[model samples]
Target chain A: MDLSRISVVVRMRSARQAIDLGFVMACAWWKPLFLSWLIPSALLYFLLTVLFHHQSWVAIWGVWWFKPLLDRAPIYIAGQALFDVKTSPLQCVKALPQLYKSDCLPWLTWRRLSPSRSYDLPVTVLEKLKGKARQSRLRQLHRENANAAICLTMVCIHLEWLLTLGAVGLALLMIPEEINVASQAWFVPQEGPMLWVQSLLSYFAMAFVAPFYTMAGFALYLSRRIDLEGWDIEIRFRHLAAKQARKPAAGLAAACLICFFAGPSFFDPPVWAAEISAQNKGPKSGSASSRAPEYERVKKQILEILAGDDFHKPVMTQGWRLKKRDAENPNGAALPEWFIRFVEFLEQNNAGPNRIAAWFGRGARVLEFLMWSGLAFLTLYLLLRYREGLEAFARNAAAKKQQGHPPNRLFAPDVRPESLPEDVPTQVRRLWQRGAARPALSLLYRATLSKLMHIGDFVFHEGHTEGECLAIVKQSGEAALCDYTMRLTLLWQALAYGHHAPQSEAVEALLTQWEALFQHGQ
Target chain B: MSRIPLDTQYQVETPEGIDLEAALAGPVVRILAYAIDLILRSIVLTVLMIVLFFAGKTGMGLFLVLSFLLEWFYPVLFEVYAGGQTPGKKAMQIAVVNDDLTPICWSPALVRNLLRAADFFPFFYLGGLICMALGSKFQRLGDLAAGSLVIYREPPKAALSLPNRPPRSPQLSLSLEDQVAVIAFTQRHGQLSRARQQELAEILSDVLPCGSDQAVGHLQGIGIWLLGDRGETTSL
Candidate 1:
């Protein structure tokens, strides 16, 4: 494990940032990560679903319980890809034995429900640690990182459920309202098909969240190690060492000498070192160091290679652009001689340009006539199409002048002030006492609508239903009136449509509230 | 293997020749930030609805218009004015910037925020999440459309606390990397465990040939020397 080859920019990061970095890695290698995770998990789900067909919950639970084992594939892929190792889904599937070879039993058993399973899996899988070593290793890693890792697990868990519900919501959106499937029926499916749909949704949701969960844990592990072991510093040092090892001794000494006298921090370390070495070497002989003979040979060979044909290869590229015209004769004649003679003949003719102009004017006049006629015809056609609606609009406009006095009737019953029996609540109570709950609730509802329209200035159109009347009264900005209207409307709906009778006491209570709300019956 | 580079840092050279680097915010943090915004939006809308409940039809009309503005222009106003951070983004310590690493402008901010509808299509940002996961810079559909990026705000530098030691030049010629490591080692004396410091000190035994017990002190001396701290006491 060469620290220099680790792909990510390693630095001390907050736990959330570490998890985010993990998400980035999972996305970058989504193909292999998804492949390795989805294939086996989906297969297990399918098998369990078939076996436990009657109990779909069992299948989902089985799939979920075995997630720790399935998580290994993504963790393996992410770990390998961090070092730029190419891996396929098939390779990940094949490496399952090696991946699951260490500390697998505990993860499947007691550790299965661990909140930080994603963060802890790499410890058992990648490090291959078991027993006491794994415990201490986890302790060290979790010292400062436990909260974030647990938070990541919690967040991903919520995200999984959210995505599942979102997916179900999207499917529900596709079902047209005309289908007449009740909302309760769509959500609370008691049958096998809906159960299967739910299982599949949840399974895919888990599959979606798995890669991010595993990779985030992996990043947390990597970041923790980087902090404890100084991986970033180690990588830089290794690169420096490799550079030094590659350069020959004499050339390095010369480079150091140049930097020593350069008075800048460009080649930082060597300059200071050269100053010390120069002082130690007594200054005079510092400029003269033994040179390797192979230097000139390598330099000449490098120059010869650079001056080779490969370096000067020609690249042909073709495209179109406007042709550059000659500046001295920018508009020089470039027309055909025949076209020029034709133009001269036309100019010489007496009725040449003016005749053409007159012809254009005639054509323009004809087009103008056609356009005006077209507009006039369209207007006539629109008037004819909507003639009945236009007549109704005019009739309604005339009727609005007479509507200063509110409409006497709204519902099927005439709610005229003169038509009502003087004390409406008393009449309703008398009807309720007679056990005629239907007419009693209906009379109360209609009387309220009539009062709202006439006295309270609430506007109820002729076609407004009981529900619409209630809505109008509620929107009238009077709380007590809205409350009374709501109860009366509900009771009216139950009796009218649903054929459910309201209790006598409930009707009496509504009549009392109605009396308090609308004092003057007439 | 994907051709995209696998790193979180997005670096861009500005017209002024300054290299601006930003840590690209990934899905987890971004999702969390968005979740915070979602909660905040829900709360504000809920409060608005309650307040406007008594105003009847006119109140309902005003509520709709206010919610529309809050829904669409909430992020835009914050990003353009509040240093590119919405309230949620500020809490998460992330900000929006142009692809060129400039402060967010009005048009780009509007474009990115408006395209959130597309990103939010079909479900709970599933399309956006997929795009962000696949994009090299973790850019979602809105970001890609608007040429913007969500990046982690640069954290303030930690106060330097090097140990008080006499400066002594390293006996052997050290490379630039070695100097850095030694300086970091000195700076992180209290953070790194004493035993771990001794272990790291042993890696360069040829350069700092002091006993294991005194290696930390010797390295501190060399770190001070590398930092150009002569015998004088410097405020770090």
Candidate 2:
């Protein structure tokens, strides 16, 4: 009821601006507003789902139908919060009956689909207006901002759908491509997990949008009232009156008399308030009847002074100015005064126009020459300053010409130098002795591939299969190295895919050949 | 009460000691303005399609190029040259401005508009919408990235044109806020109904002491005085 205590600043805002204000209000009190909205709505969503698990469509319809009722919770919290009322979410829940008591039936049934439902809810819920009075009140409120209210509803509806779909789309993206669930299952799930997920997403979207919609509509309602009632003016006036009420009556007559005669300079409000409060206190100064005529005379004098030239000084001087000259002056001011004057001087010397133009062109040419020469000098300095690095870079590039960068992984296993042990044969032999037969052969195979790629400078791509690796080695025509790779590739393929363990003697033979062919350099 | 006014106004102080304030536009109004821009862009494309139908392949090629440019640069061009307001923004009475509250220049405008693609992620502006709703200043991804803002362009205040009553000072000296209230009352005279005005004026009965019959007129007279309006009899 106290307009000064209203949380939002009262001003004449456009309908859209009003909605934005509502959003700010919602943001400021999101904890309470969203909690009050979410708790009840979420409970109802769960209850409906459990009761009508078979008929999920019913659950969806029920949740959707009860939205008008559910929306009331946030609206109540926001309305209370607007007046600086400290209501917890639990308190808001307990107070829901009071919020829904007035004209609730109409909201659920006939007026459920009202485009401006939130905007009109305040009239019923807060003001407790009902019947013909409510109708008339709505008629009055809807005159200006009805379209904005409708637009708010439309936008919020779209926002809810967008958020829901965005969530679903994000979920779809996160699911690996190999398990590509058809999008149809997401949008139209009749029963089971998908249906439940879809319903939950829909409810979540609705809940998320509820706070913004409710608060925005409430703001529209508040803004409309502000426009109609001048709530801002009332607040300021109330503030003035409050200040006036607090002043003591210490200096009464002296303050008033000085304020009256000395004009605005001596019109200090606190002193005058002390005087007025003293006048209102009793006949300590004078009786009311005796002061009336004197007050009238003072008021008349003040009005007369206000009507003097000091308050209203209207001067009118009509003349013609050179329009073209004024236009030229404005444009001329864009350039520096000296620069304009220099250009004018150049233009005025028309006889030597060609000579002056040549001199200007020559100066421009000299400056361009200086800039280019300086740039060239800088480039040369840079070249000399970093000559060693440049030469090293050239040598590196030439040394590695036409070499495909060593693939980090040969097919699946990492072939990087960092991945390999210093003595590959020793590690493979230890694994074999431990009876980790398949690992021993695979490790030997991987070591061979790594050596081929890094030491032998052989290129392999991620797509290359075991046969392709053997073909690449065969193409290289290194007899001993290619033969060793062929045997390792066969053993790796047999053990890895066929689940067949290789013979220990064959693995030992390969390990010894691998050491001879590869480890010797190391 | 919150010490600061809990409205959506963004304020910054300059080196010159001037406080520059702009009302930060939230997603609702910005969305509406964007919708308007989308419709306008569609209309232009449709019109171009018809006009270029007769020019064959060359015209079709030209149309494609024009559409690309328009799609990306329309907001940028208007923001840079048209006082930071696109046609849709002008209609909405909002404009783009730099974070420092200056008129948006070309570089920022281009950066913000081009990054609209990022804002339109996963689906149509859901990311942007969420960002705006959550952001303290209601800045979308593009706005955050470019350090630009969408703000309500405050309309010029209408001249106070109350009836030419002889000016009257209040019974008590009025404070600055009181003066503003009176001025606002006078400015909104035409917009508010007569009964509403009287009702508002009645609230000031403690100070004015004007009876119910003359309360509205008395407040207006005081408002006129506050606005520096001399009496009707005072000739220029």
Question: For all the candidates, what are their Cα RMSDs to the real structure?
Answer: 28.1, 27.5
TM-score of chain A of 2: 0.50
Please report, as a residue range, the 10-residue window in candidate 1 chain B with the lowest summed lDDT: B227-236
How close is candidate 1 at the interface, in terms of C-alpha RMSD after superposing the true interface residues? Answer: 4.6
Could you say which candidate leads in lDDT?
2
The 10-residue segment of model 2 chain A with minimum total lDDT is: A249-258
Chain B TM-score, one value per candidate, order as shown: 0.89, 0.82
Number of clashing pairs per prediction, in order: 0, 0
Model 2, span A1-522: residue lDDT tens: 877678888888888888999898888888887888787777777888789878776676787888788888778777777888888657876788877666778888999999998899888778888899999999999998899999999999999888888888888878898996788888676667887787788888988898999999999999999998888988987787666656555333434554655544644444434444556556554566676777788778777988999999999999996567546677655578799788789778763878887998999999999999999999999999999999999988976873556655544887777887877889999999999987788777887888899889899988888898899999999899888888888888888999888888998899888878987866
Runs in model 1 deviating more than 4 A are A86-95, A175-178, A246-259, A262-522, B1-5, B170-179, B193-199, B206-219, B232-236
The TM-scores of chain A alone, one per candidate, are 0.52, 0.50
**Candidate 1 TM-score, C-alpha based:** 0.63
Off by over 4 Å in 2: A188-192, A249-252, A258-522, B1-3, B46-65, B154-164, B190-203, B209-213, B232-236
Backbone clashes in model 2, listed as residue pairs: none
Model 1 chain A lowest lDDT segment of ten: A286-295
